[model samples]
Target: QAGTALLLLVAVVVAALPAPSLGWGVDGHLIICQIAQGRLSDAAAKAVNELLPSGAGGNLSSLCSWADRVRFRYHWSAPLHFIDVPDNVCSYSYDRDCKDEEGVKGRCVAGAINNYTSQLLTYGSSSLSPSSKSSDNLTEALLFLSHFMGDIHQPLHCGFASDRGGNTIDVHWYRRKTVLHHVWDVSIIQTAEKDYYDEGAGEFVDALNKNITGAWSDKVQEWEECAKNQTACPDKYGSESITAACDSAYKGVTEDSTLSDEYFGSRLPVVNLRLAQGGVRLAATLNRIFGQSKA
Candidate 1:
């Protein structure tokens, strides 16, 4: 009973403090989900609509950050939001980097993507209503999959373990003091929106949508393809993230580095590409999962 009380106290304290921005910041996740839902197949759109909570009103983007909000409540899920690779190693290995601190396998973002994708695949297969209450909590699975898709695309989410995905490396976003991880997760997107999109995330989404169908039309198919027709290709995404982390996210600077116009200018394009790819891949994964289901 004392232990339970202590745990509850800790939870209260943690909840009282401002939560660290994990995964992509709220807007980042929102942009990705918005882009994804717009590209969903007819069947996937229907399944997603049915699976979303009643309050969502068919807008998946509105709740794209739900997984992050539930971290304190779902303590075990905290690890599911990012991967930690060896410091100075510009690569990711599922067997090596996908474990939690206790060494449990399949606990990182990629594994979470695979797990939630599998869970959501059960939709429309049950004799009962696909959206009905179930042990797998398919609604939660849908939300998790949506959010993790965004997280796996943020390069620093796959950053070096020693720096805790750049969380430990102090940096400045223009003049404000922050961490490198936060810069990738939130600052870059926010700056892009402010500078070019009139501070509207919706406008940013519109620009990405234009690129998806316009400039990036040729690449979208390749981005969505999974080897051997796998339901989700998170391993590929993870690998891409680590490589981007090395080449772009962690390329320059050390502790106390100030990131300004030059840093933001170079990194914003990478951010845009990753966000676009995340949306396309998520829609592709969901389409594969629910495309054949009679909804």
Candidate 2:
């Protein structure tokens, strides 16, 4: 009965926040691919290997699919919020002044860091006792860390604090009722599926690396800029503004419209950049935790 209730709760959350049908479909694959590139140091490899089986045979493509499933279940909606709050105007509000509100915590970066630290501490504690060491728990923690790191890099994930990251800002994704945040999470990526990098994991990692090298600092800057100039930021206010900004961000990339080309063309660079950062950072975190050397 306890297990059944937990399953029901998970179902409700997944339904309320449908997993983004983003191009990769599975994110774990991306993380594993990054790991296999041999770019990571020996320590990182040992850490990841400790979590997986000894001789799990498969190329990058197959491994990636496996990783995606593991990551999705563990952290599919982890990007939604660092700290859950009650449903209220403030929940959906992005007003700068709300930063001081009792449950509010700056932005997604701070939230992601907090969540990562908490999970790691919990895992450390559990691993201390032989009876408490569960393979499932460690795997889930690694997957969550992998996914959340990726989430913080996503501009929309950081989101406007006022509107519950655009949850309250209702809009349409081809006639379906969706929020601004949802569109960014799934719609845009779905639209890019046609051009997705479906080749080997190495190729995917290489492509992602090129983008990440350029965009990491820029994304951090964008977040900081948003934090500083809350009012001047276009998407920091009302629903219309949120919708318009999202639409513009994903216009061409996710839809077949005149706005498609420019929109898709522009953001593609940013997407690559974020993915790259996710892959490298995932490797870095694993190294630190597992005592691996820098790759």
Candidate 3:
């Protein structure tokens, strides 16, 4: 009886623990990169091929989650994955919202984007010095850009300060108890039935690329215009996300905090929008960095 009781107690403790994951889950990131790849200029395509494994056949999506996979080896880089705005504020300012875990300023996701973008430029210009010996490899800069673009658009990555980007807000995904961040990270896409999409992430991304028409393609110009302007990029994307987190992602919930079709109905479109924008913006950055002029 004591053994059985102890087992029950252990299960209770385990069930209450929090599991934190970063950036869009593997699939979301993949889809974002795949979309970006399809839109890349021919010169950018050649540059990407030089950076990634030829065995992978120049697929940028293959490197989409490289930052997350190497986090332990690059411990300081973990904070570069997200930014937290205060409870009511939606916009991101480098000085205000880009602090790391140690309270040092300008170390968050937005700053990472800026820092890595400069590193990427080293490949384009003869006069520019690489950001660091650590980031000397253009591949790392490209990978970081690929990942951070997706991170910036995840509403919860740009979510509230109190929750560490929704890592604390407990919510049930149908029957499984999980945090709000995970819901956004993995659930929104994975929960869909396979009839509508493939369960395999690479395949799912292919589907998204094949099905994505030119509807949002023209919007790339505006996204690039805002992103290129340092004062506007993070502020625009981060603010838009947190505003949605407040208005849609976390808006309706009782003590139960159950996520049903009503919740998905509202937030999924937001997810879809972010995925589109991230891809478009990433392509724009690559084009500017690796276009024929640079090559």
Candidate 4:
């Protein structure tokens, strides 16, 4: 009787947990936000510091995953974390691809990015300064922007609808059984940290920062630039993600395919590149938005 009761308790606990993880893991979000906050302009930095919750201690990265944590409470936001395009489609279209399962327009990650970006833009406006009076919540906007920026960069976040961004595709990370989405979102980053960075994300961040300024220096400007001077360019980012998904993420293997050293080795560079671009573009967007805005 005790054994059966314990099994029931276990099932209850498992049922309560969030299923099918989305976006980058805690470490991935942290790394991206840390890199971004480091590159914030003086004006942007002041604004960010002013907006961050008191508990964050002026560290944006600390609250980078707040959106995910509140998904259950904010049920409407679940759809905003990802976009699902048709299976075997290698490209993304804003009008066609950026919508929720119910076919609501502007409900996907890219749209959410643009929406939150617009909300955060009101930060310095005199009429918008009083958070209590303003209809928009800049704090939540900042947190959502930071989190969704990381999400839209993850290749699988833009993966096929049939697979729920690879969430349904079961695969093995070496010897561990897990879904492909989790592989990209967490497993790969965790492996990199363990194998090369002394199990520290800070070291991994430092290494990527070095590449950003060193080998990847020439590409940084292109990554940060939005055509026609938009405050944020999520459409471009979404397009890049879907392309990368086809190129690197869903390139090979089938259901239950074992993603071992070969898969890990080749895909790690893609992961690094995406992470680098996410951080750089986030900082650039914030700089443009908060430029000359008094804190």
In TM-score terms, candidate 2 sits at 0.52
Give me the overall lDDT of model 2.
0.45
lDDT of 1 by residue, 179-286 (tens): 999999999999999899999999999999999999999999999999997899899999999999999998887999999999999999999999999988889999
Cα RMSD to native, each candidate?
3.3, 9.3, 5.6, 3.2
All candidates: TM-score: 0.93, 0.52, 0.83, 0.93
- Give the C-alpha miss distance for residue 256 in model 2, angstroms: 15
Q: How much RMSD separates candidate 4 from the native structure?
A: 3.2
Report residue 92 deviation for candidate 4 (angstroms): 0.4
Q: Between which residue pairs do clashes occur in model 1? A: none
Q: After aligning candidate 2 to the native by TM-score, how far in Å is the CA of 76 from where it should be?
A: 14
Model 2 C-alpha lDDT per residue in residues 1-295, reported as the tens digit of each score: 9999999998898879765432233443354346433445676555555554444442222343443344456554333233222333222243432233343444333344435534553444454677866444554455445555544444454434455545556666555666656555555555555456553435555555554455454553332233452211222312222333354443333222233455556765555544554455455555455541222
lDDT, residue 207, model 4? 100
- Whole-model lDDT values for every prediction: 0.92, 0.45, 0.77, 0.92
Candidate 3, residue 245: Cα displacement in angstroms equals 1.3
The worst-scoring run of ten residues by lDDT in candidate 4 lies at 126-135
